[model samples]
Target chain A: MATVTILGKELAVDADGNLANLSDWNEDIAREMAAQDGIPNLTSQHWAILNYMRKVFEKEGSAPSIRRLTKESGVDTKTLYQLFPKGPAKRAAKIAGLPKPVGCI
Target chain B: MPSETEFQPIQKVSIVISKGSLDGVYPGLIMANGARMEGIEASLFFTFFGLDAILKKRMDNLKVATVGNPGMHMPTLLGALPGMSAFATKMMKKEIEKIDIPPVGEFLTMIHDSGAELYACRATVDMYHLKREDFTPELDGIISVGQFYEKAAGGQIIFT
Candidate 1:
C-alpha cells in the first residue's frame, strides 16, 4: 500500500497506486493525481475516458481492458495511449479509481 | 561489495513468432501486447509458418493444430481425422471470443495500433513467394534475419 496527498487530504492507495476507497475519487483528486503523474492538463478527451472507465467499473466491478476501451469507449487505441501515455489501461484505471485490470491483452 | 539495489525492469523486447497454428501464434502476440502495456518497447518478427499471421489472405483462417497435439487429450489417430482440426479451431475460437479476445486480424491491428512494431521474415517471404501486398498494411517491413537482429539489439529476444 501507498499514500498520496491531494486537496489537503491524505488518501491511501494500493500497491499499483489506485485509490484505496472508490469514494475518495473526484475530479480534483483525479486532476491532482494526473498532475503528479506528469499530465498537468486534463482535456475533455481525458475526462471522457476517465468517465467511461468509472462507468464500466461501476457496472462490471472492474476496469475495462484496453481492447474493450478501444472497441466501446469511442476512443481508439492510439488516442488512448496518447491521452494516458505509457500503459494506458493501467494508468487510466489508476486515475479513474479502479483496480489494475487482470490478464494480458 | 556494493549494495545490490540496482534492479531494473525490462526496457524492450523482440518476440519471434514462428508457428502458424492459432495456438502457436497467440502466445507471441499476447506477450508483445503485454509488453507495450507495461511501457516496454516491443517488436514482433514473423518467420516461416508464422508469416501466415500477417498474410492478409490467411490471417483470419489460422486453425488449431489438432494433429500431434497431446494437450488436446485425444489420441493421435483421432486427432488426424478429417475436420478434427477445424472443429477444434471452432471450439477454441468460441472460447477465445467468450473471453473478449479478438480474432487474429483485429488483435494484430490492435497490437500494431498500440505501438508495437511488426515485421515479416524476408527469407520466409521469398521462400513462400509472397509479396508485400500479401501482408497486412500494419506491417512495418519485411527484413532479413540479420536486420531482425540489428533491430532487436540491446533488447530481450523471445522465440515463441
Candidate 2:
C-alpha cells in the first residue's frame, strides 16, 4: 500500500494502483475528501459505491452502467441522484479518485 | 503542449443539473459540454423538475428562476421578474449558440453521441406521471436511484 499526505492528512492508497502525479484537481478532491474527515469516515453507502465503481473500472476498463450500480448498491435511484446531484459517473469518479473518464468534455 | 500520454486521464465525472430555471440550465450544460471536450466521460442526470430540459416539448420552453434563490446574484429584483427569467434564458442561450456550441437539444445529442449517458429519475417520472414518450429520443433510459449510484461509483461527481 502507498500513502500520501494531502491537506495535512495521510491517506492510504490501495494496492490496486496509484493516481497519476498530483494535479490541482486531484489536490482539490483530496482536500474535499479530507474535509469529510478523511476517506475512512465515509459512510458504508459511499464506500460501497466507490469500491464497486473501482472494481467495475478495473474489470471492464470502461464506465459501468447506471442500472448495474443501482443493483449492486441496493440504493434507490432517487437516493443515488440525491447523493450525486450532477450524475452518478461524475460523482463516483471523483469519490473513487480515478482519472476523469474518456470522452467527457 | 502536453502530449496524450503526458496528460492525466479522467476516470469519471458526475454532473447534476437540478435547477429548473433556464439560466440554471446553461451552467449545467456548459459544464457537461466542457467536460466532454476535455475527453472525460460524463453523464447528466436530470431530476425533479429539471427534466424539462430533456422533454421534447418543454425543453425549448424552459425558464430561469429569478425569485428566492440566494445563490443567484441579480443586478436588480426587477431583472428577475416573472418574464425576465425567460428573457434571460434566451439571452444566455443566444450567447452560447453564438460560440458554435450546440443548442440544448443538440448538446444533449452530442453528449449521447460521445457515449455520455442521460437518465431521468424514476421517482420524478412517477411523481409527475411523465411518460417516456414525453422525453426526447436521446434519453439513454429511465433509472431508479440505486441504478444511478452504480454508474456514479468510480468518478468525479458534481452538483450544478
Candidate 3:
C-alpha cells in the first residue's frame, strides 16, 4: 500500500493498481479535491470508479464506454456519464490521479 | 515507467454546483451534460445559493451577472447591458433548444431522465425554507455535507 496526501488528508492507495508515481498523482488530486469543500471523503464507490478508469487506460490506452462501465459498475448509465464531462474514463482517471490515457485529446 | 503501462477505467464524478447565476449554472450543467454524453456516472450536489437554479419557480429566472463576476467575458458582458441580459438569455435558450438541449428545467429533467443523481443541501433547504415541492420533482433527495462527501470519494470531484 502506498500513501498519498490530498487536501491535508492522507489516503492509502493500492500500489499494484496505481498508475505512474504515486506521489505525483496524489499532489494533483489533492489540489483538485481542495478546490471544493462540498465533497469531503473518498469512498469505495470513488475507488471503484478510479480503478476502472485505470484498467481501461491500460487495456485500450483510452477511455472505455459508458455502456460498458454502467454494466460493469452497475451504476445508472446516464448518471455514470454525467460524472465526467470529458467522458467517464477521462474525468475519473484525472480525479483518481492517474495519467491521461492515450487518444483522450 | 513500466507502471504507466497499465490502464484504468473511470467510473464516477462528483460535482458541486455553488453558483445559481445564469453564467454559474451553465458550467455545471454543461459539464454534467458533457459527462452524461460520455457515459460516466456523475452527481451534482447543489448547496448554498446554488439551489436557486433547481428551484421550480426560480430556475427560468437565472440571470447572468454583468458587474462583479470575473468569469463573465466579452460576449456575456455585451449581453448583460440594458435589455441584453434578456436578449442574451433568450439567445442562449434558443441555441440550447436548437441543439435539442433542454432549458434549465428540461435540461435538468433530461439529467434526471438519464439517471443523474441530484441532491439539494439539507442545510440550505432549511435555511431557505424551501419545501420539497419547491424543487424540481426529479430531485433524488436531500443530503448533509458529510453525506455528500461520503459519496464524492475516489472519483473526480468538480466545483462550478
TM per candidate: 0.96, 0.54, 0.55
The parts of candidate 2 lying over 4 Å away from their true place are A1-105, B1-8, B69-77, B80-82
Q: What are the per-residue Cα lDDT tens digits for candidate 2 across A1-105?
A: 576565665655544333443222243553365345334344566667767777777787754544456657776444554455444555566566765554333
True contacts kept of each: 0.67, 0.08, 0.28
Ranking by TM-score: 1, 3, 2
Candidate 3, B26-128: lDDT as tens digits: 7787677566555677898999878997999998888766656555465655645797667657767787556445568867865665557899999999998
Top candidate on lDDT is 1
Error of 3 at A97 (Å): 34
The candidate 1 chain B region of ten consecutive residues with least summed lDDT is B1-10
**On residues B1-160, what C-alpha lDDT tens digit does candidate 1 reach at each position?**
7554566778899999999999999889989999988878999999999999999999999999888888899999999999999999999999988877889999999999889999999999999899999999999999999999999999999999
Runs of candidate 3 exceeding 4 Å displacement: A1-105, B1-7, B70-82
lDDT of 2 by residue, B23-103 (tens): 667778777655654446788889887788899988877765656655456756776566777776777778755655556
Q: Considering only chain B, report the TM-score of model 2.
A: 0.82
Error of 1 at B26 (Å): 0.7
